[model samples]
Target: MHSPDSLYQQLQKIGTSPALTVYGEDRIELSGKVLANHIAKIANFLVDEVELEPGSRVVLDLPLHWKTFAWALAALVAGGNVVVGREKIADAEPGTVVVTSRPHGIELDSGDTVVALPLGSLALSWAGELDPGVYDGAADVMSFPDSLLFSGLGDESNASFYANAVPHVPQGRIGLVSPSVIEAISVGYSTLSSGNSLVIVGATSTADSIFATEHAESFTPPVRI
Candidate 1:
């Protein structure tokens, strides 16, 4: 078995299992192969379309969903810094790439290249016409290949960071309830690293039923600030 040392490595280790199942207004299921394909598509888009270089800061201003998960993985796989949290993005320096699910009219400036995501599981384009200068993440990603050619530089330090952020229990079916986008991404990544799967819930009632139905080994609620 390969020891997961980075987000990319962790994703690769997931192999061909059902990696993530998200429950909310929309139900989405992602197998390991499908997840990897999305990750590759986004990663290639970041590198080729967005011109992201290694160590560049990519700000994710999106909700906790499968799309956010894919964006986070893609940023890591492209060797860019993944910046979570709304406050962090607000404070980010110029030249940062911001990925958002917000509507087209919102004013966003800071020398940042804004990429608008449709947030649809299999969307090929934005639902409505995008504002000029706003790149449609879904449409743009379609031009990229399904497999990423570049591999991330994985090491012990990267593994340690994820371990400390969210400890992984091997083969465990982890459950998350109302976690922020950052927390969800971290926990999901850790779970996959340990050869486990995730069940993410945004609604309390839905979460309770899923917990009982899935028999999740562990449950993590949103962090109280």
Candidate 2:
């Protein structure tokens, strides 16, 4: 078994199979190589564009979508401490970077940097106008290199979310519908860490059909870490 100390490296080792299949407004499928590239693009954007420093907080105030997972992975790989979900959005500290689907809804201090993401499978950019200082996550990420420009992983002790014990997922195409973004990340991390592919549905109602279509053999949520 390959033991990678970081989430970035763990995902890098995934075999060239369908690493992620998301059923949202559209069906999006990503191979391991493609997923790694997407991750690299966002990580590079976070580091080079956002100027995210190692140990700096990156709060994700997004829904349970595939992009949320990608954003989380990128932040973790770039060594930015990540906070997933909307519960902590308002409390984000000044100078921290916040990635959200609802850029207009939140109230942020001037020192905070906001990256706005559109939650569609085929979205090339944020659908409409963004606040002057906000970063359009979909459009800006397209300009970064496919491989990581900066390649340092966060210290395990400092990354509280991923550093927690992950519940074991089966070693196959696993299907999941998590109650929260944190649980989703935990399941995603464990599935990839175990070198298994994942199929995530945007809503629990679609899980049955999506899982059957993807040939996912096991459905597990496990004890939320």
Candidate 3:
């Protein structure tokens, strides 16, 4: 009632279902339990914590950092539209609350409300607040092996459909982590559930490359963790 945190749980309860991965056609099949965690995290942070009202446009103005991904997710969690342009694009005008950073400092002019959101720091704070239990694959129920396939849509304009198709992530779960080992979690589950043997190879930023390795490794039973 008073804040977004107040409504966090309520939002998560709404998004639990089978999700389609944006990476490709069948990257990872998720269930309700997994989707609930993501939405809950985002809702708690954006609605309850940041306290942004509905209809506010959050500019995801960070560089190619993991936090930007989280912020984008958080903005959606709070029911806010996102502006991914530079701070100058937002601040050149007036009466705008632009979420910028120290790196690309937006030269503030009169009447410009530049909100410097420390995305990196905020990510740490958010992660610290979460329970350690979550680090152990809060959503993964099993891994995959033989008969596994990997599919993705990617970051192209068409990728927006990924979110639309996959169950909405909880607001609180919309976040970023660099030191956060997502691939390990992903690989572990992929092999175990798919009944495919897996090999832990390095991951490249290229989605196709990463997916290729994951798919190639999923030909047998899982390699030991």
Task: Score each candidate by Cα lDDT.
Answer: 0.71, 0.74, 0.34
Candidate 1 segments whose C-alpha is farther than 4 A from its true place: 1-13, 103-111, 153-163, 167-171, 221-225
What does candidate 3's lDDT look like per residue over 128-193, in tens digits?
222222211111211212111211101111223222332322221111112112222232222222
Q: All predictions: root-mean-square deviation over Cα?
A: 3.3, 2.8, 15.0
Q: What is the lDDT of residue 67 in candidate 2?
A: 83
Write out the backbone clash pairs for model 1.
Answer: none
Q: Write the per-residue lDDT of candidate 2 for residues 29-96, one digit (tens) a residue.
A: 88777778888899889888888877788988888777888888778777777887777776776668
* TM-score top scorer: 2
Superposed Cα deviation of residue 24, candidate 3 (Å): 19
Q: Which scores better on lDDT, 1 or 2?
A: 2
- Cα lDDT tens digits for candidate 1, 1-225: 222234455555677777888888877878777887888888888877877766667888888889998888777767667777666666766567889888455555656688989877768888887878789988888878888866652221133343446443345888878877767777777777666788888867657778678766546533421
lDDT of 1: 0.71
Once all C-alphas are superposed, what RMSD does model 2 give against the true structure?
A: 2.8
Which has the better lDDT: candidate 1, or candidate 3? 1
Q: Which candidate is the best by lDDT?
A: 2
Model 3 reaches what TM-score against the true structure?
0.37
Report residue 17 deviation for candidate 1 (angstroms): 2.2
Model 2 misses residue 143 by how many Å?
Answer: 0.7
